[model samples]
Target chain A: MRSRRTVDVPTLVREAREGSPRALGRLLTLVENAAPELREIMAALAPHTGRARIVGLTGSPGVGKSTSTSMLVSVLRRRDLRVGVLAVDPSSPFSGGALLGDRIRLVEHALDPQVYIRSMASRGHLGGLAWTTPQAIRVLDAAGCDVILVETVGVGQSEVEIAGLADTTIVLLAPGMGDGVQAAKAGILEIGDVFVVNKADREGAPATVRELRHMISLGDRTEPHLWRPPVLTTIADRGEGGDEVLEALDSHWAWLQEHGQLEERRRARAAGEVQALALEQLRSRMGSPTEGVLREVVDEVLAGRLDPYAAADRVVADLA
Target chain B: MRSRRTVDVPTLVREAREGSPRALGRLLTLVENAAPELREIMAALAPHTGRARIVGLTGSPGVGKSTSTSMLVSVLRRRDLRVGVLAVDPSSPFSGGALLGDRIRLVEHALDPQVYIRSMASRGHLGGLAWTTPQAIRVLDAAGCDVILVETVGVGQSEVEIAGLADTTIVLLAPGMGDGVQAAKAGILEIGDVFVVNKADREGAPATVRELRHMISLGDRTEPHLWRPPVLTTIADRGEGGDEVLEALDSHWAWLQEHGQLEERRRARAAGEVQALALEQLRSRMGSPTEGVLREVVDEVLAGRLDPYAAADRVVADLA
Candidate 1:
């Protein structure tokens, strides 16, 4: 039954840590597919995680998130920090085939030995990014990345989900018309640890920055001991203002550590991870509602012989 | 302990069924708040549900969804069918306060006793639209609306979610630059029961329609016995094609009935609703991870003393 790809999980993990991008890629492919071997791979990677600093960058589609990610990557390379970029398209599962288009702009460091870049779509059917991204981060982390940058596409619940995963979450914006209100509308304002107004060359960059700061102050971030998010501007396409962006990220990282919030965030992430897995286990045990006790309850609920809450109560009691 | 607003649940349901919009609005407010009375309200409303046909209209911003919904409401009203329009903004909770802006275009129906229009936001903390929208639909259905139109704002996952909730789903598009490719990219191609090119008077209407038809054929909808989604043109702002859209909707509804898909989709929806409620119950029983058996398992997972799957198994065992 052994094949060329079945190269043993421990050996693959060792190779990944020894700077073999092919081995790392193979491991990530397993994660993406939700392979049966993941239990083994995660057990192997578990002891080696918790070192890389995970930073998440999110914005609306037209905002320069990809370009800003490139700018940040080059900056991290300059500092001799090993970088891992995971560009996640929460909206589309077909994006795995289109990585060449996504990565063409980052060809500057495509050959850099210290830079490990990959793009992961939610795969649509394989659970969700909330479940898979953290595991992928673990893959990159155990592979010896000093900093991991997660760039998520689209907005709404995905941004909130990304914020929960990252130690430092960056919300990006541009100088487009009504972009400030646009940011507020997407609920990104509440989740960001740092705010970046990209396209500084545009007419309304400063206005956007001012508006963001005012909005932050007006919110409950004014409470003492809580980190007040900083608004910075960048022309990411030209790689201008990248160092300042890096500086702001480093400052936030430092604040998280000093306030002992890093451990708190990581613990919260671990809790969420465990909770999702536990729920998945319970769901599988309940079996598909296509048949079994779950199906009977659903039928009863449909007939109005039982309320959904009562059906749920019955299912939980049966589970016990 | 009963406040003035604490009108008894069964009486409220009765009043709502007897053409009382006030009673209906109060029931929906209960849904938005996840009120303690919801279990009672849902039990009371369950028998009267499943009679109304729920059609979901969704598209990206500026695609004239609200306008199109208004046009459809007029058609439904002309037939003397009681109409309920629920405009759900899945992206923000603050949208409840801005109903005036959303409803201004629908001022023609402001005085109609038979037409009920309500805007529901996810309210951020109130579970999610998936868990709460069904209850709201039941409120509309039990109140004796013959046709319920659900218009969702934004796109991506929300479109898929609306598709799951509706008996038939209409996806709208505008004739603009790259609008055809935009439809393919958003993953909405798979979910539409009927496709609409809303701004048919615009520059690229014919091309967009052609592009959409070609894309539909390329997809999995060509299977025998499957309903092929029709691409139609409408000048919704002028209300030019409302009757054709209504015809298309009626045809799709008839097809669903003939194929028995209406019953299948409702069963699937009921199963999902019950599944979500069961998971919520289990999560509450597990309690907070701040301190509990769950906290211990999370700590173990963080320390790499236990893999996530193993921790999950331990937690599930503890639940039993």
Candidate 2:
């Protein structure tokens, strides 16, 4: 709803690049909503992107995703890397309200100045997680973040989409989460670059690790130089095994760079973003359900006079 | 990929209406792929739809969804009602090849002629499960099926989409499936009209039921006339408690009619179908990654010469 005249885009972008978290947060909100200055802001930030290592962490709920993310932030800070965290909460439909637990866990980095944590709710967005996430990542990347961690619950299409955005995707599991079969069923097996079994102190930790390995081995091996996803264990609550997880992520990044997969992945990500934006624009141009050519076609479809496909084709032809 | 010339649409519709399973199956396939004659086929079938009671069954893997669906088909057939089943397998991206286990279990109804079981894989389809499902339901509805059960794994966006298509959505859970928390996490609690805890013989059955009831109670109840979802127990494998499950489904259907929610749900479903078709048409018009204005804009965005939103606007304007 914020128009171009209401906010000074150039000033905000300059402030954000100069280490103003408040300015950076404002810029993120602008990009997240596809505000009027989105293009202008992205143009300003384009040169600064393609620097941060974007790592996506996904797992089922109750798999210590938040804990693992918080631990990673701590470890990354220990390595003196500027980090940004985008925790996408698909559960809540309302934006601007962060989960209480995540807020408390991330409070450790509240005054760090180098670490920026933002929780984005996937609500009221037509294109779902894929639409807003890339823009938000661009904001972090442009803000001089060395690494940006994109965390999502590895249960749905959103997780698959997050895979497309991340340089290295980490699929986290836990003991007794019924994750092996669940992961495969959700199509997470194919997207994961690194698998982490958190809560390693639990009873079924070893079994979960073994099951993930077996599933990975059974996966399609048609690509001769495909990176084999490694299964690692971690007790995130105790901050144990964080180094191994980081190592796995670093190794994946190295592999991508060595094979020139990084550029390919980034190109694919940009292509996806372009397609989503174009489709969203077309939807918006179609207008509301009560007026315009789209409405007329919809009415025909609803009245059984014209089928949906034909009506759609007619609308597209009219637009053309 | 079958063109209109390859098959006679009117003959297929007529034979399907006259209780030809092969004809009905062929019609289902045509609708599933959004073939060229889809409009003609739907036009012929529209009048026969809006009669069959559509029920959706969803749960995690190993929750006996196929077994429960077969049992429900058996029970419905025993009650002298023709039944149709559309088992949407999101796990498999290849269509036509139905699961061996489901095919074997459903072979009982193969010779009966009163029951029709079809499995649809979400394969190579840009729109995912939501695109083809309603049309497939229409095929069965026009074929004079009294009840159509749409079964999908309750994991991702597909289950949420299936909820929109079904008049009554039944979320099936089994003991030790970790479904109580998983259901809440997957946002299934809001969509389920009837909750069935299958495998009642297991140790966690009572606890799962209690947990589900508690979760349902915690759900938003601002609307005083809103129907409260009931939690039922069933040992679907042994066919025990099948009658109770059927009764619950019947009660929910009657409730939907009495509250006038059925009309509202159907109208919403039609509107969604129209929107999906229109979006799909636009996507096709945008062409593939290497051709058309879409690719040109994508190239610009990837090269960082233009932001995605700006490029999208240019594409939309070009089409306009």
The parts of candidate 1 lying over 4 Å away from their true place are A1-7, A93-103, A123-127, B1-7, B93-100, B123-128
Model 1 over residues A212-261: C-alpha lDDT tens digits? 88888888886688999999888999999899989999999999999999
DockQ values of all predictions: 0.52, 0.31
- Candidate 2 CAPRI category: acceptable
| TM-score for chain A in each prediction | 0.94, 0.94
TM-score (C-alpha) between model 1 and the true structure: 0.94
Candidate 2, residue B126: how far the Cα is off, in Å: 4.3
Deviation in Å, model 2, residue B274 alpha carbon? 2.5
Cα RMSDs, all models = 2.7, 5.2
Q: In candidate 1, which residue pairs clash? A: none
Judge the docking of candidate 1 as incorrect, acceptable, medium or high. medium
